[model samples]
Target chain A: MHGDRLLLGPGPSVPYPEALEALTRPVLGHLDPDYLGVISEIGDRLRAVFRTANALTLPVSGTGSAGMEACLVSLLEPGATIIVGVNGYFGERLCEVACRGGAEVVRVEAPWGSPLDPADLLAAQRANPQAALLAVVAAETSTGVRNDVAPLGPELAGTDTLLLVDAVTALGGTPLEVDEWQIDACYSATQKCLGAPPGLAPVTLSPRAVERMRARRTPIQSFYLDLGLLQDYYLASPPTYHHTASSTLAYSLHAGLGRLLAEGLENVWERHARIGAMLQDALPGLGFELIAPERARLPQLTAATLPEGLDEAVLRKRLLTEYGIEVGGGLGAFAGRAWRIGLMGHAATERSVVTLLGAVRQLLG
Target chain B: MHGDRLLLGPGPSVPYPEALEALTRPVLGHLDPDYLGVISEIGDRLRAVFRTANALTLPVSGTGSAGMEACLVSLLEPGATIIVGVNGYFGERLCEVACRGGAEVVRVEAPWGSPLDPADLLAAQRANPQAALLAVVAAETSTGVRNDVAPLGPELAGTDTLLLVDAVTALGGTPLEVDEWQIDACYSATQKCLGAPPGLAPVTLSPRAVERMRARRTPIQSFYLDLGLLQDYYLASPPTYHHTASSTLAYSLHAGLGRLLAEGLENVWERHARIGAMLQDALPGLGFELIAPERARLPQLTAATLPEGLDEAVLRKRLLTEYGIEVGGGLGAFAGRAWRIGLMGHAATERSVVTLLGAVRQLLG
Candidate 1:
């Protein structure tokens, strides 16, 4: 039996009670009318949570990484040119996925724990004029830096280049306007801020992105992740079978998304901001330091500098073992130096912050 | 609110109670040690269930289709040749996935509700001498035909061509000896015979398949479905994160597989055989005809020819809405003429067959 720990880590955060309840409901056949009804409601609620009117909004059958792969592979053909911003681990991951999708990748770099500059993307666009897609991570979970995406739309406005965003950690917790931001494609996970488990990735594509998919010279390398087929399967009336979807996971997402919309997206974002502020303010007094600059700090995921001489792994283990509180160790450049504490969705609460702070104060003093 | 309907579909049959309870457990962090231990134990149990000592045995994070994608994309490179046996929908799906994975497909045909002859595969091999993989569906869920895989091994004994089996509807339902049958790669879904919710796809690869993956000329096109990385992530002691594995789904599978092992594999298979036999013996007396030949018929999935003048869709809807029972409409060539009734895992009980048969009798009379 796994012990119940307070999940403050990067993801798989404490799921909503409704979501958990939904998961235990009886399994439904993939194409069952009742299951399809629940899934359709999920799409509607997901659109409200995403703040987008995009028709292709539906959860991919895999995790967030699968969503990322779907966006890249569907929009890009082999030998297509894609420019990706590499500010943190997820951005670098975008570059890697673009390469794996058989795209010629041009990377524009920013230091870890910092946001990607839209100006640099503009310059990169000038260099790679034939770029088919430009991608970035809106919330870099590894570094807790949130890139400003508003300026990116104007930079690639006239071109046929489609803008893709990884909103895996940003969607429900942060302020994201997919349509207003001119994001051609965006993908996110159910776990991070959706207050659900980590099995489904909700993705939406703009009409422009769908057009690019339609004109692609080659078939999407993955039949499973093909958006055209998925669009037809999810959005089409009397949906045809593409693959067997987990009705259990879909119901969980439905409940989770319902909770998010019920709380109101703005209120959810504000809760994250308040909880994030509590962590940043109080944890520092307990001998921690904020890692990312305030200008680009992510409200949902906070990367904090560990006090000097503290072993990140040992402290995290102690937190888990002693207090039943879980936090994340750093990755890549921040390894051994930082910890990622997520106050995402249901995990973002005043009581949770107080409990965490009290535990931290006790441990430190 | 979804109604609880009896799922007698070809797949996504009734899930086990323990599996449902396991899914409702508190969500664990993706990399939590306790969760990792659960996953490790799941691997051992999956190995035992698959009856293979293959080192690279783990569940793909998506449904069965994702497992098929992972196998084809990881083993075959662009322009490689693959021969697929097309006896049903899934076999045609195998060809589609292979083609999407950039393999040139040579399709060997058999009519619907019929088994593929090994001689056809031999002739296709002679024609496409450069074929890297021979793919086939072990249990044709659409037609309720179970192919004998024992003959395919000898046909490819000395050749470099690897045999891939889609055991989606076969595993845990029938007697499948992976190593003895010389299956180089096999993938199955949790929802079918595994008695778990449909979220994960359990897959195993032979040493030869692993070697082929290692020697791949191009990178796996989709990073999310890359099995080489998943192998390390699942089997390695200090597993690194490839993608966030859903502890909820993993625990559900662990619980489901444990239930299977606890019941004993032989007893489980026998139970299915017994239940399937019961359905086969009684359904015909209610004016239903078995579509597949008795010799090649699948025990778990029974494709029955609908009586003349009985509407397939109307009867299925009545079965669902009126009697709270569900059965599948036929696919491909069998559509409108057949109904596929599945007796799988938890749904393969004597009580289920009795209820279904009684319902059919009442409706037909």
Candidate 2:
């Protein structure tokens, strides 16, 4: 029953063997001393990876979108104003979540396959001075655009607006210095560059974000995603039970993090950069074109525009069924026009690049 | 790193070998045909287990609490009236979730280790005529009390009050007829009686619950837990991308549910009843008494009161460190007074009962 296809899709890249083995470990009670130790170690390791000493660093029990919701729902109150940068799918999702939270959303846009401009966000901030949060996607999974988060700090400076970054496809693959970048809240999933099975969402909230949530006049709507209670459960001495956390998934995430940290974060980033560059360079030789500009492209996710005559869905299926390779079709604005190929974590290897390139050549050539 | 402890705690009983093996299966994309097949099979299997033909029956991506929040946060809008029956920890949580959702909560109460009186709910329903939801825990894990849900159908027959049951610890271990009992919405976890590791929450929503959610005046506060979007992703013709569902966890849940269905749900329930009776009888012979009344007790969870002067924490610690056995310490109002032993699914066996009994006699004697 095990489907052994080469994972080259936008997420759930091939997990490290040790990490997959961790999933097979005997399940422990969430509060068991052994399991608690795993949770504590994961938190510490996550801080190191995120390059932040924020004590609220831990994995949420759901996937990447859950992390996004946790940040927005906790930091924004109903009637609060949030400035969202819309350049790609995940960025647009931030606007939807903000609107759902009853926040007045001011969206600053760039083209779908391009990075968000800091000047646009600055203008949005000036136009909506009451904006309490500026949300953007650090790495847009849909279009593979990597937004430069460093400039946003100075752009929204001297304002109480907290910066929330969706690091879903960026965290382990790119240089995401949360503390150095001055990001208030950032969330990522394990399936992308972390090389873990999809489940846990690693989220780090700055002291500022925590304080903002603490000062909220209204309680966060969903008790399951409440950051305050989650932090209490993860940080409190003799941690309180906020929910019954999945100790099995936690073990897998911890093992995955351990593998990454062992590889050195810089080395992992360099590997993804190398593999992604190879895929981008080789695909065009097989008649595929890169969608996003090179400078703005994410090393973890590469959105490649299909050749005019090639049917995107048909080719993707052939790659899956014929070559046993999996890659994502485009989403939203880029739908049917592009294909998203992920070079992430364990899947970001020369062999994967060669295998996918050969398969594309076999079918498309 | 695999801690080999006997899981006799309130939940997360030892996963069946097949379920554990399923977790080790190669990961697939969430939208992969193989994975969608798995998801469909799980939905069908869950309906069989839940004893409902409700088309909305499927597992939520988060834990049991996520399922609880999904139902409450979806069915009740801000300022909606929700009367919650609080007889144990989970019931109190229902109240808290309702209040957090901006609902006016009217709590109908009973003692901690007892079931809520059906008459009290009818009165609460009379007092709060506008109440849109009445939530209760079918099996209270904290107190090991199983609330009688059969009478709830007739109590609110003529009203628009939808019943939301937290069957986190009850399903697959007891007789729960979702359609027959006219439950509006019900949720349970993959662990506990399902014999899967804790991750997915199986929730079934009746047509009434779906209609109520569709009629909501306000958008559901939680974008992650919204049942409407989730249904589209799971049940739609071409499933939409809600979030990246964990294929690994889905495989595990499917394998676990298959084991249950293969054994027959009635047989699974009967096995739990027999095992629970054995533990209840044997524990008293060793001078331990069950906290919950026999008639209202859950067969899967036995909250046994400790003998006077015996510190609950110390004894629990000894059982763990000395015998590699894990039983839950008391929670909420029953804290420091009882041990919650779980007999559910693969863990509810003649051997498990004997092993736990032998371990307790060794420690307490």
Candidate 3:
């Protein structure tokens, strides 16, 4: 086993103690009655966390990117038009996956470190009034920006367009209401703020999104990600065989969600908000400049430029080797010039912040 | 955590103790240098287990089915012809997924509980000589039959068609030589004979299969399963980030493989064969009829028809509730009639066979 290191990277934040304990439980068959009960409980927990009444809510059997692929492939068919807000790495990825599935993409642009304007996204949807979906990242992990997802949802109400949100880094750490925000679909990763290992992608789809999926003239491009088939296995009586799901991962996620809900969603959000503020508040004093604008920043993840005249890779390597703290390197425009520090889930604590800051101060000196 | 129950199903038999312990180890960043070392070790061990020196061997992030999708979408372009041997549920699934990717499938058929005749597969391939791929299941988990995958590979050696094998139930539990058998692309699940949880699909592709993937005319249909991009992430220096892999699962699989290699592959295979024989030999005495013919039966999975007038579901449930043993129900032709009992990986032991038989005998009385 590798030595324990503080994970302050973009994601895969430190796992909860309960989750780690759950992983050691004896293996259960996917269709076992008791195991199915665990799955049902997980679904219920996901619903409460997503703040949605969608009956189709469940964890997809892959990571966050698989969740993204599932949503795109399930809803978008050939020749369909989608309006995607592109401000960071994930948004660009949305366009790439949509295009591969034969959808025509209309991009709404914003600077890398700035949130996409809700007005611009709605305008794009209006121009392509027949667009099937409008997708935005609720929290952009790449740039630490929180797009204005709430505004776009209300505007798309009763329109042909469905609002799809990427909540990979935003889910349990920030304020997100799938039902209240009128999000047709949302996908999140367990490793982020969910305090579990990175294997499952919890996704919720509204009635309208399911309707669009059923109404598709062409077959879904991916049989594995096809929500229709997955629903048969997850929700059907005497569930049919879909695939051999990882019951071990499900058990771990169940424990993690149980811990989160016990702490209360509002309380969990508050803790993250406070912890994120502490780190963000201290970075500037240490010569690190925050990437996201003040109004658009995400609390769970912070992207900051390193102090001038220090090699980013060299310093990050020292932080890892000497201090055993892992921070993320910048992507796209910030490559080699910035660090992405994540204070999420179990790692979102005052102690972690103090330790990381002290380590950075020592390295910089 | 759920109570411990013996998993005697098609796949996900039971996890090794070492695997369970490994899962409890600290979670690592997906790209951590030490975690990367774990990945590299896994690749080396997988190469040893797969019995091939294929450079593209790596685990896909989803279950065994995702591995199937990866091989199909990676190599077969739209409108490509694929000759698939359809003798069980997974074979039918192969045709379904291939068709979803826009490939025209020509099926070579056999009875549900019977193995596909290698001569018939050869005949189909010869008739459709321009076929891009010829696919078959090395072990048909749905019916407990081991199809002849070795003959087809040598026949297609000089042809343009690639030989794809589904070793989901065959790998590690039985003799499989990818290099000696000339199999081009093969995929298996960690949950089956690999003694790990059902979250990863270990796949190996020969150089010729890689050549066909590179020569694809159109973009691969699924971006998540695109082997070229996955290869870049798994093999490239300064690896590009494709998705957040579960290091926890990798550690579990690594430990499982290590245990298997330490036991020696031939010894592991012999244990499974002996245990399977003990179970099969006792079934007939218990008024059960074996499904697969003697020559085609798989040592890892045994399909048998229960005594007349006994409800299959009730008996299985009794075994679960009264004895805490989980066995599989039949699919396709044997639905509600046959049981698929698997003794795979760590579950393949003389004690397991004796316990299962004792429970069956008691329930029958």
Instruction: Name the 10 consecutive residues with the lowest summed lDDT in model 2 chain B.
Output: B149-158
Query: Between 1 and 3, whose DockQ is larger?
Result: 3
Question: Which segments of candidate 2 are over 4 A away from where they belong?
Answer: A154-157
Candidate 3, B1-365: lDDT as tens digits:
36798989897888989988899888889888999999999999999999999999999999999999999999899999999999999999999999999999999999899999999999999899999999999999999999989888889999989999999999999999999999999999999999998899999999999988988779998988999998988888889899999999999999999999999999999999999999999899999999999999898999999999999999999999999999999999899999999999999998899999999999999
- Label model 1 with its docking quality class: high
| Model 3 Cα lDDT, one tens digit per residue, A24-62 | 888889899888999999999999999999999999999
Q: How close to the true structure is residue A99 of candidate 2, measured as C-alpha lDDT? A: 89
Candidate 1 per-residue lDDT over residues A1-365, each given as its tens digit: 56898999899799999999999888888788888899888888988877788889999999999999999999998899999999889998998888998889999999998888989997898888899999989999999999988889767879878889899999999899888888899999999999999999999998888888998888888899999999989888888889999999999999998888888889899999988988888877777888889999888899988999988888888899999999999999889988999999899998889988888777777
Q: Sum up the clashes in candidate 3.
A: 0
Residue B108's lDDT in candidate 3:
95
Best by lDDT: 3
TM-score of chain A of each: 0.98, 0.98, 0.99
- Candidate DockQ scores, in order: 0.85, 0.86, 0.87
Q: Please list, in the order the candidates appear, how each scores on TM-score for chain B only.
A: 0.98, 0.98, 0.99
Going through the candidates in order, the fraction of native interface contacts each one reproduces equals 0.83, 0.86, 0.84
Give lDDT for model 3: 0.93
For each candidate, C-alpha RMSD in Å? 1.2, 1.2, 0.8
Interface RMSD after interface superposition, each candidate? 0.8, 0.9, 0.8
Q: How well does candidate 2 match the true structure in TM-score terms? A: 0.98
Tens digits of per-residue lDDT for model 2, B1-365: 46798999987899999999999889999888999999999999999999999999989999999999999998989899999999888998999988988999999999999899988888899888899998888899999999988889767768989888899999999999999888999999999999999999999999988998998889998889999999999999899888999999999999999999999999999999999998888888888888889899888999988888899899999999898999998987678888999998899999999998888888878
